[model samples]
Target chain A: MTEERDPHLARLFAEAPEPQADEAFVDAVRMGMARGRRMDLAGALAMSAAVGLTCVALAGPVAQAVGQVAGQVAPVMAELFDVPGGEILAVAFAGLMAVSAMVLSRVRV
Target chain B: MRPADSLRLSNAPEAQVIALAAAGSDEAFAELVRRRQGSLRALMRRLCGDAALADDLAQQAFLQAWRTLRQLRSPGAFGGWLRQVAVHVWLRHARLVRPPLDPIEDLDAEPAAESPDPAARLDLSAALAQLKPTQRLCIILNYVEGLSHAEVAASTGWPLGAVKSHIARGTARLRRLLSVEVLS
Candidate 1:
């Protein structure tokens, strides 16, 4: 159904005196915003610290797992392709894993 | 910009103020709040039926608006955007702490005694309180906030048909309760 304008109701609202926001109210809101900003900063710092600690705690196990996977895979690759320096490939793969971990840690999402 | 310069921005047009605000000017945002807080608070008061709660909701709305000011694509539409934010804040709060049903009867039992003529304001407030939340919101947004039915639908994210129906039913109820006949 189409809506029709109700001027009487509109007039009642328009004519109703508005409640004023005193200086105290405005100051309170200003303070509230300042507090909110500080909280946001604190939250961001806390998140960053948490992510850093998590990465630090997991770094050892992650590195170990990456090294084991590379140790098992690099020789297979070397044998399949007749490539030398399986040890070098293993170290390179571990380094790549560390860099990826750091990158992911820095990402907010 | 210096602190004093930012205060001067309050005299600037809304679009200019919004632009400055988006650029991280707290004073510009404060100016916007100073200008718009009255109507926002009034709308909240009418919706929530508690002055203190309305003010709290208004502050929350302004804070939310400041955080997401950059998302506002049209600087000219700040008022409408702010109103939308206020409504969302109220809706969220309502969802968390749902009001008991039959608020109208409660208000009717003990009308506002402060007003010399309680019948006038009390009747309207009581009648409004009786409306279902969605119907009350639609009526307030359309009549009180001066939004068209389509604008009310867009703001509330309700279907256009639902908005129309709510307004129609709400208005009929209000008219009957107020004991006033439509002039035209």
Candidate 2:
């Protein structure tokens, strides 16, 4: 047990290689976690949509009001979405905004 | 890095970073990865005895840490937690890849480190090679990283007395094997 303090062995242990993880690997793990969160949010949104559709089928007047609002907004939204890739860009922007909101809520400010 | 921007909580205390990481904070996880990578690499090198394998194992360990972070019992105990994860990663890989045994005979015949380059640290590595996989891991964790016998036991899931015995026996064998080169 006393010989356990042998400097040679200790030095060897100290000298053993210690490599650092690169930024790329760290980025990959972060991306994986973010992707998982995005998928979860997507699933929740889809489930919500399905439930909303079921409710709309059961409630005629409420569904009619929803349709009226969509009818009014659809033309403008359609124009905004008409450009090539515009719909995708808009969806991405909305997702980014939601993520930003979540992040901001967690902040001290 | 700004407080808002730095994201990596590595600069914070291990407990703080661990808690943040456990709660699903990417910055905290990144910080944990950055802070522990060096120690993990050193431990893996001793256990696997190959630089490349050590690198791969260290990478895999970080990935596992991400998946298992929430299961960690105490945020304050993250260092030991990471070490434990690394041991598991090494053992898991050991199942698939049979690491080369230590060349004890070659080591015994080699002279002391009079070489100019520190690359001769391979002598220490070769001595570690002589140890059985578990024994080598215990030695590295106990002697090299300076973990307590209980910490080693807890991390490796070995009994307390068994941990002591492994350390004592492994240290004695390594000392005898490297006595010539290490001592002279």
Which candidate should be chosen as best, given lDDT against the real structure?
1
Which pairs of residues clash in candidate 2, taking residues 3 or more apart in a chain or in different chains?
none
Judged by TM-score, which candidate is best? 1
Candidate 1's displacement at residue B51, Å, is 0.5
| TM-score, cand. 2 vs. native | 0.60
- The lDDT for every candidate, in the order shown, is 0.77, 0.70
Runs in model 1 deviating more than 4 A are: A58-109, B1-3, B99-121, B181-184
- Estimate the TM-score for candidate 1: 0.74
lDDT of 1 by residue, A1-109 (tens): 6556677877767776788757677677789879988999999999999999988887776666656556665656566455566667656765775676555544522
Give the DockQ (2 decimals) of all models: 0.41, 0.27
Report the C-alpha lDDT of model 2 over B54-160, residue by residue, as the tens digit. Answer: 77778788878888888888776777778888888987787567654232322333334333443444367787887767668778887777878777878877776
List the RMSD of every prediction in angstroms.
7.0, 16.5
- TM-scores of chain A across candidates: 0.54, 0.36
Number of residue pairs clashing in candidate 1, backbone atoms closer than 3 angstroms, sequence gap of 3 or more or interchain: 0
